[model samples]
Target: MNEHYNRWLHHRGLDPDLMQELLLLSQDEIEDCFYRHLDFGTAGMRGLLGPGINRMNLYTVRRVTEGLARTLIAQGDDTRKRGVAIAYDSRRFSPEFGAEAAGTLASHSVRVYLYPSLRPTPMLSYAVRHLGAAAGIMITASHNPASYNGYKVYGSDGAQMPPHRVDKILQALAGIDELALPSHSLQDGIASGWIKEIGSEVDTAYYNHVLSLSHENNATANQQLKVIFTPLHGTGNRPVRHILGELGFTQVHTVSAQETPDPDFPTVSAPNPEEHDVFTLALTEAEQYTADIVIGTDPDADRLGLYARNPAGNYTAFNGNQIGALLLHYTLERKAAKGELSSQGIVLKSIVTSEMGRSIASSFGVKMEDTLTGFKYIAEKVDRYEALNTPFLFGYEESYGYLLGSFVRDKDAIQAAMMCCEMAAYYKQAQNLTLTEVLEILYQQHGAYIESIFSFTFQGKKGLEKMSTLMDTLRNQPLKQIADLPIAQVKDYRLGIDHLPKANVLKYLCTDNSWVAIRPSGTEPKIKFYISAVADIIDAAQEKKKRMEKDLRDRLETSL
Candidate 1:
């Protein structure tokens, strides 16, 4: 018997059912589950829910909250009094885990303002700042599979707790010796005013702010434009539809099958909108309605996907980079036309996002800045630029995440949906062009830019070791060329540059301006390779991207 496994099984405070389940785990499962505690990366602790320290269960949630509580306590009584805001998405046990976190913080004498039901992540950020809370906790795995759940911590600034604060939280977590300690009673906290349930007030305020971001206030008056939206059984349903309905969008139709919040996500294999396959039900519905455009939000409602009717009259999906480029063009073009474009206006994208946005921003005389791969970094820029008295026009990552307004500190699918819909309505009504057509014009003007991401999932201990070894090999022995393209520049983010924190990421720019980035996903058990290709013609760019993908796969196979 592994000592760690037995220690957990024999712990007196362990849940009896969980202990029995652990007792029955196969040898390999036991090792996989008990080998080590789940690593709390920059994002927070996320893993499969099961009976082990490595999984996301009540105990792990409590431990993380305990760390957060300790960090807040150290910040002083005022910080603790300001408390933390808590919200959850439509995942199994999400509410239970959220309540557990609230109890844990209350046990530490810290106040908690928790959403009464499932809510999107951005609302948690808004609530944190709006309610003057010291921190926020969102219980979600974002777009990960249903088997996974997560706990993401946000700073008082409503961004993901920055690296320095994350370090302090980790320091406090290290001091926690007991993993299965029960938290205080949530009911007791509520009765004593230490835990407050927040609902309609926050929702109304968030809805109003998102509505204010719309450039076309009367966009809903375009009753002729057919629109279809789906929330994929997550938290986006109410807020997204509510905003659209209030905006007077007369022809909005939500995918009825996916409107209800279901943790099982019964209709789709994965709830991620990035995967076109997940939009099967929505597409079918769109075709029936001959919808002008189709929009869908992921499980947490943070990432959005757009499907538009192509020249061939079929619903074609847009990649994250393509979506970002289209939105950037629409926003900047409209703002410039309205004389709202600021001299100090800027757009922010992650390092791996498509350069097409940069081209669009430059055409409008707006500066484009690159941050590390997460939205947290983008949010940091938003906060910084606001303080500097510059306008943050828009921000997006290549993973289908976008933010248009500073009202929310995280990627907001609700806001993206509103803006994308408004843009579509404007183009159709005024320019006599569909969004896809506008995208083609942008591509023609900027040259064709194609981007693709390839990820290799490594599930268990061996997989993790392989991923580490692969990163190490890439870092130590860099590739000079990919498919005969000469490497022009190599940027190793780990060494740090431009005031950004050190990260395990590598990017190689080719002589032809094409680039490929290699990094392990901070939140998932996969190593991701991001490839971007540019050519005068779209066909040429597509061919180059396919060749690059093939070459990358071959190299990874050999290296691993």
Candidate 2:
């Protein structure tokens, strides 16, 4: 074991107070805690809250912030003067982590604009650009469970720091000799003007930007278009509800059980909007109100999930791909109808996201670009497009993240919520069709696009080794066919040399319009398999989907 891990173990076992707590934990639990330092990846740091070197606590947050501060100082005096913006979600110790980060930056004579209270991740991204800060920090684990918390660093462009710069940050982190809590108080730092508290004004600016995305002014105050919303016990409750009310959405019902920001997230096992369990309360309320649409945002409100009512009154969640495709088509059609579709208008999506978005973009003659998985890549593309005078129309990923305007660099669930409501209304008013009906129309026009995501979780050191072995096996041996489709092309992002601009990923293109991409999650210890197929008819699409899913599962089982 490393010296740090040994010290941590000794502290837990020898310290009387700690021993009392340690006695309750199993051997496996203790081992897990002291196994290794929580990884500080390109996305920054994330882990469970504890006293070990591997945990997320004031000391670890300070260490990372110190590194960021040093990196800024090295850039120049002007960069340091520009400072960093900080925000936190409603997780346990999130506020403390935000304060710790701010105090650490202040100790290095860097200015900090910490949010007055918990704020969404998009707000932190927006504040970075809005204040012209050198960088930004958001203390959130996003959709992770309540036990977990994280620190995400953003660049001056208002996007998460790119991978190349993250390497530099890691190098700086390595140079720090001692990882200890800062001596100075964040409250004192604020009093001395080194740390500033920001609120309402930023909220107004963000809300105004969201309102500007509306295409039509005639929003009929209809109770029949009932909408139900839940924040999943996170920071989105006030902002999402307030935005919906202001947008003339009259019969908007809030999930009372989950309308408050509770770090414990007592209502569900996990606060992730991607999980169906988090929607139990909201779905129940939706049925009672006969809501036309149901929407929920994750802890930091960076991702949005939607459920639409079918003709049989059965409510079903729409996956990220479907939502992305719908938003792309709706935004383009409206822009063209208003004669506002510019020659320079552009749409962005992750490489693993549904290609149906690309097809929709093509139909409107709008440029569509694909970035790597993270929203940071999408934000970087937006920054590049804006610098070149290209108008960014929309950007999304397959993980329930979507961004509408350039006001916020990362995904904004508040904006996505409002836009989805508007899209649902437009579809209803124009064609007397539901959002699902519009989706079917999209399938008929452009061949039906079916996509699915499969994730395999691996934990601890052995799990990491297993994950690496699996990736190596897949890379060395290619699949000849999947579900009767001959594999025609293979894209290995890990062999960055092969692709020139390398990424750690592998993609296979079958002879048919079906494709599969395999890549490890940057923020989590899991490998994701993305399968997509496009067929001429609905029946063919269904058949191909079943076969592809079965083949992928079979291969994954054997390989594992």
Candidate 3:
């Protein structure tokens, strides 16, 4: 075994002070932990918190931050002078990780604006742009379980750092052979003004921006609109409720048990808004209040989930695609009705997202653009449109993430929450319809667009190799048919020759308007298969989706 791996194993066997604190770990765990350093991908570093090179310990955090500091210094005096903003979520070691990052930056004489308490990911993005910081760091694992944590970096534009800059950050990280930082204290940095504490002022500013998005003039006008909201035990509680109250959502009900931040996320297994089971608490409350709508944001509050009453009176969670289409249609339709629709307006969605958004945008004479799978790509598109003097009307991904008005470069669940409420209220007034009804109307007008995502986990080194091999195999041998339907073309994003920038992905377009995409997860050790199909009627779409899913399963079984 390598020296580092042996050290990890020795540490595991000793039952020493540090080892005990990290909980029970086996030899295999030690090997996996020390095998390699956590990767710094397009999003940044993420891994389980433990005492290994591959783990998210203080040493790894410092090394990454030192590298970031070096990159900032290389940019020149102005960039270093502007510094970086830092925030943490309510997770184990999150605050410590934030402090370590700040101290590393301070060692290089870079200013840091660290949040006084836990803050959402979107707020960190906002603070970066609001403070004119050179970059930003948010210590969070998002909706992951308690065993995981992560680091997300943002650029000056407040979007997740783009691939080009992230590559530079990785290069700088490699330049530092040692993980230790020079003698420096985060407290001392704060005392010397190199680090500043951000608090309610920024929160108040962000809440004000959310309130400005409200189209409801009379708070009492929508008082009858009963709403239930849950933060899923993350950082969205304060802002989501504050904005709802400010917008005069009188009957806004909170999932009382889940309103507080808990690092353990005791209520749910994953704390993800995309999961139907995570709404257990909110659904229970919704039942009591007879709520018109149920909304949930994940741990970091960048993604939003919606649930509405069906004609049968049972609440059903709307998938990300359904919500995205509704929001796009509503935003444009309202703009047109108010005579605010501009010729320069545009909508952006990830390439993997539902194409129903395109139909909605086209109905209003707005241009729709597709990017790679990350919100950063969507933000980049927004930046491009802004430079061209065009307007950004809306943007979204298939993972329950949405953005409106571009005030915040990343996904803003707070904005999505408010807009969804407004859309629900508008439908209520205009057609006496609920969100579910709005979706039915959309299905009737446009072809029904159905999408499903399947994830296969491949853990450890061997699993990683297997995942790469699988991607290569798919690239080398493309699928000609799925469920007897002919595939028209294949899109290989990894080859860097696509409609958008290159990524490590393959998309197969089928003759029957069905498609399947394969890509590695940016934040986890897994691969995701996204299947989408569109048809003139809901029954046809449902039937096609069934066949496609069965074929995909059979193929994966045989190929893997």
Q: Rate the local accuracy (lDDT) of all candidates.
A: 0.89, 0.84, 0.86
**Cand. 1 TM to true fold:** 0.98
Give a tens-digit lDDT track for model 1, residues 44-70. 778898888788888888888888899
TM-scores of the candidates in the order shown: 0.98, 0.95, 0.96
Candidate 2 lDDT, tens digit per residue, 364-425?
Answer: 88888888878888898899889999999999999999999998999999889988888887
Report backbone clashes per prediction: 0, 4, 0
Residue 504 C-alpha lDDT in model 2: 77
Model 1: residues with Cα > 4 Å off, grouped in runs: 219-221
Best by lDDT: 1
- Residue pairs with backbone atoms closer than 3 Å in model 3 (clashes): none
Specify the poorest-scoring 10-residue window by lDDT in model 1. 216-225
What's the C-alpha lDDT at position 112 in model 1? Answer: 95
